[model samples]
Target: MFKSLLSDRPGTEPLAAAFRACRTHFVWAAVFSALVNLLYLAPTLYMLQVYDRVVPTGGLTTLGLITAVAVFALACLAILDWLRGRLLLRAGLRLDRMLSSRILARVVDIQARSVGQAPGSQALREFDNVRTAVSGPGALALFDAPWTPLYLGCCFLLHPAIGLLTLVGGLILFTLAWRNERDSRPRLAKAIQSNAAAYAAQESVAGQAEVVRALGMRGSSIARQIDQRRGAVAQQADAQLTGGKYSGAIKFVRLVLQSAALGLAAYLVVKGEMSAGSIIAASVLLSRAVAPVELLVGAWPGLVQARSSWNTLVELFAKTAAQDRSRTALPPPAGRLRLEGVTVRLPDTETAQLRHAVLGLEPGQTLGVIGASGSGKTTLARVIAGALVPTAGDVRLDGAEYGARDGDELARFIGYMPQSPSLFAGSIKDNISRFSSATGLEAAEVDRTAVAAAIAAGAHEMILRLPHGYDTALGPYGAGVSAGQAQRIALARALYGDPCLLVLDEPNSNLDQEGETALMAAILGAATRGAAVVVVAHRAGVLARVDRLLVMRDGAVQLEGPREEVLARLREAPPAMVAAGRA
Candidate 1:
């Protein structure tokens, strides 16, 4: 029955899997926590013994023995508490070891599928909240809460009236905590949303700082960010105020209950119905019984936040897990690229980005795609390189569907350069090698590949002229390099490892005439080496050597065939029409 219950809980399977991997530590920590709670009764028992047995009978030996036992119990309690903390720390570390990599990979996958629309950093932050909550004092308080009844039972043994009063106090505090959660949850959620909006605003401004400054839009942007931040702060303040009210009520009620229990016990003593020892013990036990409830009230906000974070992470994991289950491994591609009726539909519009784009290229074939701006050339390039999946139809390599292969593995054999080239904070060699150490490649092999790719891209001479040659480090986005230099180095990276498929988008956008010649040569060289090369460009000069041509307009192919035939057809068309097609 317990197994069935566990299986029925959402998110529990993954959580339990992690716990099982470190079950020994968890079990020991739990045992120690239980022992520590049990030892908590020692103080109350010692007070009862001293007041009733030692003081009444003047028994010094009895007092000495009781004191020694009380001290020993406390010492044991300290040791158990330390051990429990250590065990929990180890469990947290083990959980991180088991899940962090999987979570990070899933985040990357989510980002790719969403085309960077999703807030991946927020998702990662949520996961971190879950981990911290699991190892935090709030979790320990929750574990100890169940033992509240035991302490109350001990109070009942002292006197029924005291126990009943303590129970009522606990119920009141619990009610307050429930009210706090119910009232503040919506407010907290709104605050979180506002915070995210504020962060997004800041990120947008930061990314376009140069534009903001150039257009004198800094003031307006700052105002917008401030508005978002103000909303977030206001919502947070409201939530805290609501929670504080309930927290204050709980604390007041707890104090009253403790004093009332003591007063009632004293009244009973005066009436010869109870002893003084009973009063002291009853008060102590009542305090212990209600401590967990007090702790819960105080930590209630953080607990709620953690619960929300956990749910978000579970949803993300579930989505990623489904994707993983449907994916399969396939043999490496052999440069035979085919697109059968491929279509790409934008999420926010009715028009398709690419419509029934059917094309094929065998080994050693070079295809040049030319289109006007916003004619879907970049989209086609992305789809061909597997950066964006087609909305309809199939992308195949060697007669096998590209979707069948893992995305990362497929990416390894395909070289892609986007319109705006980007580089990480690494040396030129590392960028060209794609940071191959991450793939466990040896240093010598990485160096060989980097040097070869640089030469193939005609970047070797330029790179060598730099202060440190290939060892020179570049800042984010290839800082310290000219636009032409960055483009060539990016080309080098795309050509690395002699990938079977090459997709270059606007490869000459920032290149000089010399660099353009080098790029054209590189494309021809790739085709000669039995690679299937696809270049998307607006320049006719870049497409002069292509064996085939595809001219796209309005997301559909308007002209396609052998280069000579396409060029001949274009020549016969009106000059105005040809210019419009280019536009």
Candidate 2:
């Protein structure tokens, strides 16, 4: 209900709800701040008493007592300020505890929906920014800024002239702060975008260092990445320069106005209007009044960035909400699958990559999808594997729709190996077992599963050849292993648990003759065990063992039949058509 009622707040429902959950901590922080601010007046009041009463009365004992009282008040003020900081820190921890998991899940959803378009790492960084703003000086400034008017009011009680001066100074500093925000925001935002792009480019190039090195393009790549960083740095410098000007002007105005208040108070003192105590007190009061505003001015950029991060999170959460996923369990699934008129369209356009692709597979059946470059074979495989939700049409597994099913549960039932092998940094067994250790499985059970999968993919012997065998560590993108070795291990990962539906997109692309034999064996092994298999390949020769064949051209299926018939037709077709089908 909060989600619907808080339409104006976008993603604030969960974040605000967490704050409400931690309201007690915030309340104590606010209370501590009030006490701290109240105690701030003690020193001024003590000076006034010393100047008006102690000095005139020649009572040294009374001066000693007042001094002690002022010292105690200051001590209490320091303690309360410390307590407030702890409270804000605790509140930040509570917010992180309540929302961190959900934020990460949203990141995964974004990446799975569109790879490399909106990076999930950005989501993590944004969450960290929001968390820091919640606990850092920015949040403390918000609590203290409320006391600005109280200080100004106290100054007014001292003298209307002094109050007026402080007010003008505040307005001037505040105007400068507003102008700083207005002028610097655009440049800062551009810098942030530029930095994100540069970091992304750098990571991409580093991950594919082998490709760049082999092509002898490392120098050009480094120069391109450096140029991206240079642009970000230039924009950041511009923003800092713009903000520095306002900061300097605000500081100058504050210092000058503080002295002017002292001058005015002194003149009044000489005229027997106000006491000497009032002069010193007025300066202290003016500084207190504007200090919160100054702190806020310094923290304006961070506050703005935190708010932007929150908005992005809101948009992301809305798109990926799964309210009933945990509450309602899906029916038990079998390998039986169907894609009725499935189509995947290009973004912001009507061009479909896979148009009305209708297909089906029963348990224990093997289907080979063959096509030339730019054909729809890969798109179809992605749809079948549940990686890409079709732009149109229903993908049915048993009686349940694929898109409507829970992602985690779906993973247990489907196995998909993409054209590229993505093996994370871990032991070879960790990658092949999908990090099953995190599932709290016993070591023996995990090892059993890992070894079974490796055997299925013909990678057990290859893994044993390594220094640590299954326990060997891999760098990012499986750096410790060769490309073919990584592919074989990824195949093992896909084959783990003997998933009911298995889809391999170009499984043999990185394989040698021996690896090709293993690839054929893995597909046949899974098929024999009642898993429906779909193998997408550019080279039709590797698919000779498939039970059926499918040919795609221009996002549409051109031929599909018994494997022998399809192969025979390709041979008799036009040379261009034959090349497209067999290439």
Candidate 3:
């Protein structure tokens, strides 16, 4: 069963290549282990020989000589074992880092659909499990596997029958353990999934701390949910324990097989087919086999987990990223975007969110996209920004086919701010620069210009009072900043790139009137600088500032013209008309 669990799809070329990079250390380690084993074997054989000689001749000097030789051999074995173990450990650690780096790179390259579909915990856990597998049990398994057979072969040469018997016994034990491992694979996979779900549920409760506290149902409402998840985790732990027991049972069965082999060897010696010296030597070899067998048994769980992790990692490595060809060089946008029969569809969902939507925006134009929540406004913006592919349509930037260009280059031409912006754990300067090394602006440049711009955008004078000013440390996940401050930081990051067009999803959110005024001024500034802007706004004051309004109702343009014209039309009809049109 244990053997079966380890029969994963062979590792890929990259993993093999990673292993090869540490070949020198592995070679030296193996050489040292072989020398130690040989020294260990010599002392055992000499002791057996001395015993037979002493029983017949009663030689004292010969016995003393044997004792000294044994002591020397043991000393040599100890030194070699220490050296080999250290070499192997160093090599294993190096390989672990190499493989981890490659895996993370692949993870970063993964497509949106695959990345989104994969649970975050699963992706992260796989790397850790595989690293332990490769660096710990994996290294030991590799060395012991070949070394066991070599040591056993020496015994076989001295007594062919004994060597053959031990071989057969070991094989049976391995087979039993492999089978147990195989049967546990699916159970382990399911257990991992269950654990992930439980963790996600726990995170949900923890993340919404304010809501749970404000509702004052913490002791009564969430307690039941928390208890349910805890029970599920306990059940998963029980399942893993059951699998562990199966492995233990296999080890016990192997021990019985080894005992049987030893008994048969004794029978051969008694029958006179084997010499007493050979019997003694065989016994020494058999005792040595115990270490190898136990090593394999102990490594079984790590190998099995590693196998599962490798399977997932291989899939990740083999993935072909979706083609994103929006990077071709194009003339800077003259503030014009044309969409022909644009449609937006989700990869994992059945329904198309936006159907055959048509729209156009000329240079210096400000389009306002307004609709009830979940009306596909955000999806449409994503398509226009080239972050997402339209099911059927072409988005032309300044009359150039958008898809023909490079996606990365297109990103450089447009400033896209999603509903929520992510900030790394760093100083204010790092948040604004986002570590972009795009030729003209470096981190220091962003520190001077971008930091002030972001503060100006959000009317954030309070930021100046921070202990380190722009260099103040932000906690991981931007915990040090407020929602409004983070948003402005995102705005600063967007502006740092000096994009030709701006797309803001909810720029007016979490801002006071003064902050809103700064945001409007920033948007107008971009337009005056020859860049067009498209905004998704709900605030009346915010909507009134835009040059034009493209109200999206049911994923289609409802009323698009000058801002005053659309606002007048909206006023003539009841507010419910906008909701009904969107529905």
Candidate 4:
């Protein structure tokens, strides 16, 4: 079901899709906005009638009737204005619902493929900007902008001179808005880039706070962050300064034009070409006509940002769409693993991290991998666990290539414990259950499986000693737990649900002697349950129960075969060579 949801081609662009979802609400908003603008003319007309007819006749009855009509018009205007805002709010919410999930998924995909930090973490924020731009007062102003000519036409009806002056004022404000957009574009783009860099630098320092303090590099780290921040602030300030100048100029032009138009209207009135009513009405119409342009000037920066963000999201989604396309689902794997000519090269370098490495395993078998650091042991373990895809080779389970099945589906059958264990901020049960809601599992089932897995990994007793036992709330990175305790919990997580294959990379690195015994027992128990087990170890204790041994040197396999035979051969080698081999 999830595969189909992600794989289907969106019939339209993401932004378009979101807009389409809220099309009805937008339509209602546009209609109401138009009504509201139309009603705006009522007050101007009322002033015209009062000056031209009411005062001239001194008709109290006509005055009362005109006042009643004006009040009614204003009441309708208020209702329409409220309706527009309500519709816009609905549209914004609908747009969010339509786009947020897809964008978030794209972000996760980008982060997974990135070698360093991905800049797409701000995708949701960008999406919010787009939604805001669509629903903001600025957008409503743009909608009303097309009606500017109507207001100008009313001014012309009042007097030609008044109409001409208003037209020129509108043009000047538009010119200023255009200039603001042009000047702010590049600066805003630079500011965004620098801000992203600054954030990345700050996150790096936060992640390595312990290392920085240990090496006395805190001052240098702080200096680097400060430099990045300064760059961002400088670019942002420059953009703001440019935008501010244009905004000020536009405001000044608007005020001068309004005063000039009023003067022109008064002169026309005195010359008998227009009336006192026409002059007041013309001034009101002039303000109404220029309002949209003023709004456009104010919203120029946000509009540009939304455009850039939209383009970035489009490109990101296009890149990841093909990878997420639907594939044929395969039945569950049976722990028969194969790596045919597997090879992996390090990023940005020709050197191989794993060179044409090949291995196979059957159910109920345990393979122990041992070698010096950088010998591709961890890499091979990762490949088997489906954590890393080989550059050239096929990894298959139960005769089905890895690509034939979904990653999440395959993950259910594979238990992977990396060298450095990490946990989320959650209860012990949640961590052990691998955050089951992500897998669509029931709460009761998650609890049952979590307890069983904890027992299988020999972590049940240790967990029971905690203040809250399985309900203990862990801080980020599993704080409040010792290294040994965290490792045991991670092991329990890997063993959850009796997975068909178990891949352990230095699983016992932080374990005590008792922990090591529990680890050996877990390995044996898994093998007895007809599961394939792969252990990457640096110590001999983990090797005692393995059925087979594979030794690695550099990026290639150095030795393989039954554990007894490999151990006998290693014992016969010279002492210095054996010691170096162990190292």
Candidate 5:
């Protein structure tokens, strides 16, 4: 833990900027706390001095005055302490807000493919770590720095010998705590990764509950996930326990040091080497000195955790958009998409998903891509839509290449819908509009378009049967909606954006006969409206209506021609069913 804190970049400028922004109020609050502590310290000194001097001299008047002043000081100290607490609380809240905003912006600015390509749970866990760092470590740092120095200075002024002793003890404790933190950090990071894997296991089982039950592996699957999670938690708990024991030992050292100082002071008073008043003042100061040490020891672990989280956030935000960094000075898209010898290989897969596969489409021309499972149809769509850059070759959108343009700049003209579509939690209208701020589209206008798109996708009748029409709430990832309905909602969203080119990857994969027919009509409708459309078709019903088709196999185009000729060829050569279901 000590190593983690010591190794971290001291005082990040972003955090410093946040501190400076709120420094005025925080400084005043620190001053108030210091004054309160001083006042609280004064009373012990006054009582001892008066007893040592005035009682022996029989001066009751001086005693009474000192007593009154002491009481007043105590009251003032209480009020100041209360005010300081309020100020610190507000300061913490503001720091949390600042960090939260910055982290959220960083997460959004990260490239979509970088996040999406990660194992789903790992990305989510990384975000959780970022949030914890912001709220947990960010707030603690604000309250700690001022208090440590304040009390340390007070101790020195009271008695330098005892002050040095206390400071040495604090240093020892801090070193021990730091070591513990450093040792625990790697374990904590490992636990976090393992827990993410366990979560993934649980989600996988839940998603395939029917299959698991059919195979009689429901109990085994759940048990395996739970056991894995338990093991991870146990490792984390062991690290925590070891760290706690070391922390406790540090606290014990503090107690012994404090006791020895008090004992020595009493012995000196008895031997007439030190005055009773001096003993009293030193004891008060000693207590103040220990306060910061105790607080620091307690806060060190949180600091390390936050640093670990900060590293994760940095890694997440460092991804360049569309996985390319060479492109500069982007040009406008001209609605034409050309895949010039494009190829992609899955990062962790041994086999290439695509290999130097070339294809192209002119402006306002629809091109349907057909392939067997693992034939790289969706990979081609991703490359064309500028979501994934090709491992080899380049995609040109009109005269300008995709690699030369920014992801957002290219995305404005090219829209894409994946085989498995995910939706946010909101009303149907909100999901359909994607919270876009385009000037002409309002909530009502989006609702109207959503309904039209749903009807075109053969989802309107099902949506109307729900509790509300377009106003209905779709739970997270459209949980309450059917698979087909979720697909329609995604299609609606993509259609509502009305991009120059639409790349739909197996859009009819989850649809029924009726739904497939409606979707095919919608594709034709989009083409009628001059929006170029490219679809990956498996069913014969949707394939028969397309203008042209390109057949893909083993990561390259096996055939390409007019739709009628391609269909005739496909009819003559039927692919195996098990080999054709990519999902």
Candidate 6:
């Protein structure tokens, strides 16, 4: 675990490798820290010489020379501090350059895999925390912390009494830091969890705002969010209050000890045991001795947070690195999809999600899948769309097994329209031109293809009626358009490239009667263009125009035949059986 914190570069081990690559910077920063701490002695030494030599002998020339030397030492100290800061800043930038993009890709991949079940955005925030804390006060404190003993040794050389007091003060500050960690850790952890849950809830509501507002539940939704986060807010407040108290106590200790060193020196001077300059000299050294400890104590929270973020990132990267990175790209598929004994199982259970399911589609074939909820229709659709890989079977396109890199190339040939309109923030033209090339083509060629796709989906007139037509801007998840409108736009996207494999999961769920007619026409039109299409719907009415029908139950296909044969069997079945299967 600790080894990861010491490595360099961002290649496979992004965090560790980056740190290792910046090792030179860390070494120079440490060297500068040492020089700065040593130069700090100049102030104490100058005070000792001035009061003992200049005041007692009244030597103006000697005082001037020593003062100049002290000023030079101070100047060098300031320069070293600045150089150290620059080193750390550069290291931070280097770390970011190596890790940020990798972290972002991992975040997106995690979200895509979980289908938004996991709040992966939190990982990006964690990356920010790590970067900030690494180059912020906590890291500086780390470099300075090891010099505390050297500072204390100097204090002892001045006077053992002064050293003892500084040591006691440092111990007190360290104790308070420990107490702060103990006091804040639980509440802060709870607060973090609550905050994540609240954010996930908000994303959920925002994604379904159309449904929530249409049902007049907007007020209740806000109330629900507030209630969910009340505990988290309370926990965060309590943690901050406790941390503030400890920090205040640490400052109080450092201040009191510095003054105490001065008083002790004054008493010794009064007894003729030391000269008057000893007072200031002892005080300065004592202050320097405990300052590093005070910094470490003050930066305790940031140190802990950075450590946590590092560990989290390490684990995430470790998992990702274990997977094969090399992927082979295959040729574009010819619309022949064959699934043989495909199986998908729950991660923690023996129960299968898709059990030994076999299906096939030739070019121009239209298959409608019908099943009740939990009957694996969505899972099958996801597998066919290459969104999810099968656990124990082969999913082949044109006799080629899908490789990791092949997915990207295959994407150009597979058009998947999920039940929820999967749209991004962009112009309608950009969204419809999913596979359109931006360069090396006539501007008219790209626009013409986008418009052609929209026209084929029966959305051309609707788009033209809008203020910007194909150039209209949209928000997340096809926002800036109504549900039916978004659905039509999505269909256009799926039909954009005239992809050989088209998979739509409940594509007509949000459509009106006229919209439904257009959708049916689009499906038939795609098949006429030699694209193999699979449509999943719970109701048979929407699938009336399909060439074949497949009914699923408990993750297995229960019935499959030509469309007419399947419908006739469903009609002749007993009413109870028909309702049970929802066929």
Candidate 3 vs 4: which has more TM-score: 4
Q: Report the C-alpha lDDT of model 3 over 1-583, residue by residue, as the tens digit.
A: 1223232333345666666777787688778867876786875578576757865688888878887888888898898888877776776678667777656545554533242554233555776676666556555655666667765787687677778777876776667656656766666676666666777666767766767889996886467677767777776676567656765775676566557656766788788776566656776676565456567656766666677776676666545223321254567667588888887666587777787887788777777778777677888777776666676888888888775665556677887777776677888777776655344666566666666556545534656766776778897667787887777777776665666777888877877766678788878877777777888866666766788877776666667788778767877867775663231
lDDT of each: 0.84, 0.84, 0.68, 0.84, 0.67, 0.81
Root-mean-square deviation (CA) per prediction: 2.7, 2.6, 4.9, 4.0, 5.1, 3.7
Candidate 1, residues 1-583: lDDT per residue as tens digits?
A: 0122123244335655875777787678778989999999999999999989999999999999999999999999999989888777787788788878767777776665556454444776776676666677776787788899999999888888888998998888888888998999999888877887798789879877878999999999999889889999999999999999998898899889889988999998898887889888888899999999888877777777777777666666665553455565667777999999999886667899899998989899998898778888999999898888777989998888876777777778899998988887899999999898787999999999999999999999999999999999998778878889999999999999998999999999899998999999899999999999999988778888999888888898888888888877777877743653462
TM-score: the better of candidates 5 and 6: 6
Worst 10 residues of 3 by lDDT: 1-10
Give the per-residue lDDT of model 6 (tens digit) for 1-583.
Answer: 1354653433345666677888888899889999998998999999999999999999999999999999999999999999998998898898889878778766655443444443335777777777777677777777887888887887777778778887888788788888888988776677767877898798889888989999999999999999888877887788778888988898888788878988998998898877899899888887887787678766776667666666667656654552326665566677998889998874555688899999888999999998778888989998898887677898888887654444446677888889888888889988888635543656688799889999889999999998999999998877899989999999999888788999999998889988889889999999998999999987566798899888888898877879889878878988744654564
Please tell me which model should have the higher TM-score, number 2 or number 4. Answer: 2
Residue-by-residue lDDT tens digits, candidate 2, 19-82: 6777888788888988988899998899888888899898899999999999999999999999
**Model 1 lDDT at residue 574:** 77
Tens-place lDDT per residue, model 5, 127-222, is: 444334433433334444456555667656655666687678767876876777777778767766676678777887887677899999978987
Best by TM-score: 2
What is the number of backbone collisions in each predicted candidate, taken in the order shown?
A: 0, 0, 22, 0, 3, 7
TM-score of 6: 0.86
Candidate 1 residue pairs in clash (backbone atoms < 3 Å): none
Error of 3 at 329 (Å): 6.9
Of the candidates numbered 4 and 6, which has the greater TM-score value? Answer: 4
Measured against the true structure, the TM-scores of the candidates, in listed sequence, are 0.93, 0.94, 0.80, 0.90, 0.80, 0.86
Weakest 10 consecutive residues, lDDT, candidate 6? Answer: 1-10
